[model samples]
Target: MENNMTNKLPKISEAELEIMKVLWSNSPQTANEIIEELEDTMDWKPKTIRTLINRLVQKEAVSYHQDKGRMYAYFPLVSQENYLQVETKSLLQRFCGAAFKPLLVNFLKEEKLSSEDINELKRILDEKTEENKRKDR
Candidate 1:
């Protein structure tokens, strides 16, 4: 993990994640812009969206800067990749006894993986295996 990802990140709720997704797709959007983008998909009121934004700001997961006279543009402080890493690690620790193989096997057995997906997983595992071999030398 990078240095920025090493620190504990503030927990983000599912609703808050919706706002973050919009910001992640395109950064520094005003509250109104975010609300507009989500309006078609979400039934939330503008005020409710604003409240979620406020919570994210308070959590330090999002920050804003004055874009024009009164409007502020908001962006995510946390990267999507970093957040996923933390969440994946937490899930593994909580339910998988911190073991990766069992979880991976379970997913492989349960999920309907396409040929491309299986090939990709094989390639990744092969690369990791070679890297570990070199390190052990």
Candidate 2:
């Protein structure tokens, strides 16, 4: 199912990630549309972009349907949030021995958080605590 597919997500390179970002912003884009968007920010040629698109397709991260006259519109098969969740778990496993508390502590200690950001974090923690309490009952 969807969970199994996510567990097997292909490893995406940095360059491939840039292509995914564009698709994530707006989907069902033709190759030319993707090229145009990236041309403004990236130094890569259109062919290079096309190659990256092909690679993503091969990786099953992207899927395409023929638009018109041999042209195709591509869309992401994987959601950005799902990909981020997997990547975050992998990162935690690799760096923090899969201990989430240390990672949270490190980030809270090292990174500057706005008052609003801190409040949001507190809200999320409170919600989780409440959910756990209800489950234990």
TM-score of each: 0.82, 0.84
Quote the lDDT for 94 in model 1: 91
For model 2, the superposed segments whose C-alpha errors exceed 4 Å read 109-120
* Tens-digit lDDT track of model 1 for 1-137: 58556467899999999999999999989999999999889999999999999999999999999965789999999999888888888888898785889888888999999999999999999999999999999
- TM-score of candidate 1 versus the correct structure, residues matched by position: 0.82
The digit string of per-residue lDDT tens for model 2 on 35-122 reads 9999879989999999999999999999999966889999999889989988998988898895889888889999999999999999
* Top-TM-score candidate index: 2
User: Scored by CA lDDT, what does every candidate get?
Assistant: 0.92, 0.93
- Indicate the residue-level lDDT of 50 in model 2: 98
- lDDT of candidate model 1 versus the reference: 0.92
